[model samples]
Target: MKQVFKRPESLIDVPAHFCPGCHHGIIHRLVAEQIDQFGLRDKTIGVASVGCSVFMYDYFDVDVLESPHGRAAAVATGVKRSRPDNFVFTYQGDGDLAAIGTAEIIHCANRGENVTVIFVNNTVFGMTGGQMAPTTMPGQVTTTTPFGREVATAGYPIKMTEILVHPTIS
Candidate 1:
């Protein structure tokens, strides 16, 4: 018999610290699978920003950088610019990428940075309790908005990809 469910070599052989029912571990597995499939284990550098996945450095075997809150894009940009030969990627949450680091990601995309970004949008801020995030869906309830989100007063949940792909004129 052959083993078909071996863990990816790019990922550490340890249990993840993510909360139960959370998709962070799933996302990590996907990233590790890609790294292993592309034989980039030796060339990949991951940037971990503040949020639920901040302990990613302990999960991946490759070099990992811990960026300030919502600054993963900027840190990854520097890493990629300095080492253009390496494959740099950033793992960030909706709160980090869409709310706090909005400008960083937009500018990085605009400048065509040679880096990959894995943005996880869970709607609420996972690390800091279940608070409303920039990607929260319409009428979604959170710690910050116990009565469900009020679009009239709170404005709309931002669609980051839309803004990145096509910026609207103010």
Candidate 2:
């Protein structure tokens, strides 16, 4: 019989470790499908960020590199520049992309690197025990902000996509 229920050709056989309601698994499958549909599986290079999805390399059946905490963009830039023919992409979370790697993301976007970024914004830092992240909404309660985030002290969450569209960056 034909293999109709088998996993996608661009994804690994192993099950993901994300939470039941987490969207990482869906995003991973979408990326994998895109890689296969676009015939880029052989020439795709994925950069895994250091957040909950850090183990993204284990799920995709392609070349993957793990970036240091909040450095996926920098690593992706190098990979894309080094192999212009290959399709490079980065998987990052709100915390990884909006916090420690903020400068790197800004610089990479400003340079207009030919890379796709899959940014997952769940508000809080899921991997690090749900701490308040730069993307966490104001008044959101997290492990680090048990009493809800205070705009007066913690400041408002960073709007990454909006920032990326700035004239200087876009």
Candidate 3:
């Protein structure tokens, strides 16, 4: 018999600690597949922020650096600059990327940094007790917002990466 199910070499064989129904585990698997497909696991350097992906180092068998909340892009930028040969990427959340690290990501994008950024925009902050995040939908309830988010005060959901999307960035 032959083994038909083969796990990505970049991912470790172990159970993940993500919440039930959470998409982190699935997302990690996809990222691992891409890393393996590109054969860049040896040179991949993952920058993890203070969100759900903080434990990315545990799952991916690659050099990973923990960055301050919302600073993963900034840290990845520096790492890529220092070692251009290395494949650098950042795994960030809505709160970290859209709210706190807005400046860093914008600058990083504007400068056309040669790095990959995986942005997970879950409306609520799952790791931080399900608090409302920048991408939280209007009228959606969260721990931070007891009676649902009021559109008048909270405004609408912010799509930070929308400005960066284009046919080509050069």
Candidate 4:
């Protein structure tokens, strides 16, 4: 038996820009592993928006495109359509996906866009001073919700996957 450790070929061999204990590093490795496994590194495009995930361009060895806040999915849609041969994916945080990018993601999924959306739901806007995001659970406290999120006013956390899975909105 032989044991070996190596970096994914699609991943850049460099220190991650994420904060200590951040899962972004692990997730990035997984994305890179998939890219390498599928031999899609040369034909892959990662879309990142205004959030911690925007640094994906620094970690992944493939081509990356930066988008405005909450527009990763929309940008990825265009990329996948324009370059049908390329594999397109978006890396977005809770605030970027579940909040401002909600409509874009929903529409993209509903349209059956051939793209992967890596939505990171951390509850807080980690890149923006720990603010409450749409994915923040009820009763969660943050800089914007020091007294906890009030369901009566804030409603419930948006379950994006579930919303995207339903065939019809009721």
Q: Which of the numbered candidates is closest to the native, going by highest TM-score?
A: 1
Where's the lowest-lDDT run of ten residues in candidate 2?
A: 161-170
Candidate 2's error at 70, in angstroms? 1.2
Candidates' C-alpha lDDT: 0.89, 0.89, 0.87, 0.89
Worst 10 residues of 4 by lDDT: 161-170
Q: What is the TM-score ranking, best to worst? A: 1, 4, 3, 2
Per-residue lDDT for 1-170 in model 4, tens only? Answer: 67598899998889776788898999988888889999999999999887887888899999999996888888998999999999999999988988888889888988889999988778989888899998888999999999999999999988888988873665
Tell me the tens digit of each residue's lDDT in model 3 across 1-170. 99988889999998888888989888898999999999999999999987786878789988999996889888998999999999999998888888888888888888889999999888887787999987898889899998999889998988777865631465
Range of the 10 consecutive residues with the lowest summed lDDT in candidate 3: 161-170
In order of appearance, the predictions have TM-scores of: 0.95, 0.92, 0.93, 0.93
3 against 4, candidate with superior TM-score: 4
Q: In candidate 3, list every pair of residues with a backbone clash.
A: none
Q: What is the lDDT of candidate 1?
A: 0.89
Q: Which residue pairs show collisions in model 4?
A: none
Question: Runs in model 1 with CA error above 4 Å?
Answer: 167-170
